[model samples]
Target: MAVTRQLTGIQVRGLLGRFDHEIIFPESDEFIILHGPNGVGKTMLLELIQSLSGTLRIPSIHRTPFSEVRLTYSDGTQFEVSKALQETLPLGEELEKQIQRLIFRLRLPDGQEISSTAGFDSEELASPRFRDWASRVLDLEPVGPDIWLTTGGYTISSLELLHKYSDRLPTRALRTGGGKVDARILAFLGENEVHLIETQRLLTLEDPDSSEFRRGSTRTPAVSKVESFARDLTRRLADALAENSRTSQELDRTYPRRVLQAHTEYPSEEKIRERYSEQNELRKSLSAISLLDENVGRIEIPKKMEPWQRNVLWTYLEDTEKKLSTFSEILAKVSLLQEIVNTRFLYKRLEIDRRRGLRLVSEEGTELGLSMLSSGEQHELVLLYDLLFNVQPGALVLIDEPEISLHVSWQKRFIEDLQRISRLVKFRSVVATHSPQIAGKWINRMVSLGPGTTD
Candidate 1:
């Protein structure tokens, strides 16, 4: 398998046909804060980067209003995307002509370039199958050849809808813009891993299998992401427990033979005691998260024991160590999440429950539902959960308007929290925010996006 490249820099010219911007991430620091005022394409730039990243549609790159975009990777290679200027097509143009209206070129790292007439076919967009997909994924009505009516009483064009709802469409749907050029572009950029957390971080899809989000429909269902993630964590803990059970059963079945044949030299009593202390502390940590039984307490080892007794105890400790290692990854993530969120919450405590996934408790010992959290609290929880759980190691995370719904104090702590998360999870992050508190003292990490400037 080919290795995916890590994005190290971004360059865009004529963003919105007025502003130019460049950002180069520091080698040592994983955080890049994009500091700029509104309408300067801060969010649009993130969108373009994400769209160019392999996880999104290839044709959408041409739809963005940038003269050109160049992404530099850690391997000293660059991928450049640019659009060939064209006159606006008149209304009522033929579908075939419209399919080839906008031309886009993707320049590869090796000095080779490929081009595609970047537009989807109207017939394809108007097909019964496509309409069914749109209905299922977005709950939009296909009203015409290139027009869709939303539940909000608003009509959207095919390209606009495709760009706006790109995340909702499946890969196969986006693949309808078929061409050899698109295939090459997709192949070249497909190795990159990228994730985007939009400003509206609190809303989540009610249906797991469908992307049916209706902006203004009373019938559209929505769920609090905090509640949703709690359920997800519950399932993860259940899986880990099941795996641990299997491992314990296998080890127990061979315990007798291992204990009987133990002629190996045992560690000194002091060393044995130290290992016991360490393991005991580990058990207690996991127990706090419900990964282990709450009966775990500091264990006291006897100073004197027969050789056989010592060997049996050593064997048990070894087995216990193996069993507890099952929760190592989960423990690190949950612990960090708790540390960050609990510190910011004024009177509430966050706990992990084996059956409930995430449990929020009041200071007076009252259990709080996910809905009880204020919008700021919910945003903090949802964003942290996504960064810790949904994103993979070495992937690039794009966070837009992270200060939204956050207090000034929480905003100030945001960068520090990200720094801690980066140390544990190992991913590059690009934060776009208007809050000076969000930047705090990270002046070296700030990338200001403005007119005719590079940072």
Candidate 2:
């Protein structure tokens, strides 16, 4: 039997000064179409489900500050979540602390009230099934830290947490082997891959599958390889310097003043020469100089880093490993992200080749490869890339406005493709568009965003 999560009704509280609000989700279709103009809280409604399910959340940018997030279903199953948002006070005062704190609350069907991160205990919150829902699905994840939460689904926030269970991971551990935990999480949330985009993106807590490598290198991380090279370089430089310093001081009175490195035998030879010197003054100076230089040589940094600097890699690796292994879904996203990056790379290659074939590549080379293609073709390629980011099946997608850059024919075709993509990946989708052409050619079931009425 096909797994389905029927949305009967929902209630939200502590959000945008809304103590409580009830939304009756359309029951006929598997997707929920939240219609609204620019300012309405259609996106906010979508984020609520994500927060409750441990999926990522797209924080509100406009008005209606999302303070509390709560939801309820037809069967009275509900989820309560609390969020804390506010800047901290410079001065330390207990009473002023509350001013800097914002909290959200959600009530689930079982009467369980969830507040902020502190409100839910990890022991009670960790569920193997949530891990499952997020695995193998695609369609929702943030392009950057600007959007919090990594899982993708409805509202660019809600995780159509995959309810389906498979043997890819263990039922209790919910992870394959800690190597792909992040990918596993993506699979459950209806997205099974992730991509790291933008030039000079931070390597902090980033996955290793990013396809944008240093042109041609092994899949090994750029940072790791560079670090190794630096270490070897440091050692070689230090050795060469030390050898020169020792040879310089081994001369007689008329000997040309030059530095020489201390060979392994230099320590014993220097003792013998000092005993036979006319005065101990020159001998003491030479020995002292050699000692000072040797100490400096000892201070030389590793080829890649200083000891202090290298320590960061250790700490970062430890923390990343601990946090990453807990979520098996992340592995799936990392795999998919690699594919997305490769696609972008291919697009770039195609553009470069097209431009070199004799055309004005100056004023027109805005986005490199993207500039060579027609707008429609570019949009289609971009859509495919976006779709690949969420490669897992059985996901629920809510699209606010899909006709932004599409044409009349593309609107219809894209909608059909969107429908087809869901079937291939096992997902459910809802789209909102203002294009009358799309409306005429496509869907008939649309929930209007006009003023409220008891329809």
Candidate 3:
């Protein structure tokens, strides 16, 4: 079941520096977003909060175990962790700025100290009590390299930041390896796993067609069949029937987790080999789908937006075109590689060819179709991949001025569709945009940040 998150608060310390203005806070949600114009300290705000956990610069913190920090969270909480630096012991330490650790002291319901100053390094390391409230509260983790940070003289690129600290990206991630799975497909698998595990146990019991799994006395399926049965029977439950079956099966397989314990050694030899081969095939298709998906997110651009966006998109698309043109006979195969950017007449030989056509009237028509695809065709495939990619969990999509390179209709319609799909797929998008219409789609999550914002 989809769960709601609490609006618990966080106190940030070791900030490179606190924001001069108060940072806003929302009561509850699985994720939080921040955005703003250049120099508004959008990056700074994310860094400050990220520091509260771990993932960015430590030694360059604005404050430290060393004291005094700015707060960007809410106005309500039973108690907050307050502390003063032990200044007296730093007679000659040069006031270290690096924060090696961020320790959060929690006040228990029984008014007891959960720790005697002995704390864990990360949130996961924190005691069970703290995790129950904090883990689900923040749920922030690094999705991949698209992390954006400006702390410690570092420029975090699109492949460097994640809202949550999970290794879910193509790089080195946990249990989920880089198998060419688009982010969305990966998420679908996870949701399926959650539902399938339980459905297996009960579905087999309800329809015990195979006597191989019958229990000694009861009509229960065999231990090994439990897992397979759930996966099979759950697969049988389609969209509408899924909910009904999931509900009933959930009750039947209430002890699904416990069932996993029965298979002491894991999957049988035959099934293990079968899975290995199946996984290889899945990865090949997944890679192609992911490559095409990056373009779909491009559809979010608004019709009436800023100029920098159009300029960026134009330059990028033009550059790619020039390179590909060199391989074939495109417009006498313009020598883009030989052209100079600052030349007075860079486009001296350029002509508006919006009405251009590719003529291939022969058995080689199939070959011509491959060589002369229109820009619009490329854009559509990109959008398709983007649509598929959003179904994955913990995706951090960094879209820079997403309002360019396509029709206005695609921009509007895809915005609404993308938002709905992203949520179901476990994605957290951070876009640098100027379109109010695009921003409106993600209104509840808007966190504008950039330079000129104080810290």
Of the candidates shown, which would achieve the greatest lDDT relative to the real structure?
1
* Candidate 3, position 93, lDDT: 32
lDDT of 1 at 240: 89
Which candidate wins on TM-score? 1
What is the TM-score of candidate 3?
0.30
lDDT of 1 by residue, 1-455 (tens): 65656787899998988988888985566888898777899988988998877654555564567877788877666777666543332323432232223444566567776766554444445567767767765778887767789989999877677568655554444332255346776676667778899998787854433223233333347777888899999999999899889998999999999988948687667767777888878888898998886455345578797677778778888898898888898899999999999999989999999999999999999998889999999999999999999887777899999999999989988888888887788788999998989988888888888844343
lDDT (CA) for every model shown? 0.77, 0.36, 0.32
Q: Each prediction's TM-score against the native?
A: 0.85, 0.38, 0.30
Clash number for every model? 0, 81, 49
Clashing pairs in 1: none
Worst 10 residues of 2 by lDDT: 159-168
Global CA lDDT of candidate 1, please?
0.77
lDDT of prediction 2: 0.36
Residue range 47-135, candidate 2, lDDT tens digits:
44543343332222112345554444444544443445443222223213322222434444456644432211112113433222333
Error of 2 at 338 (Å): 20
Off by over 4 Å in 3: 1-33, 47-101, 106-415, 426-434, 441-455
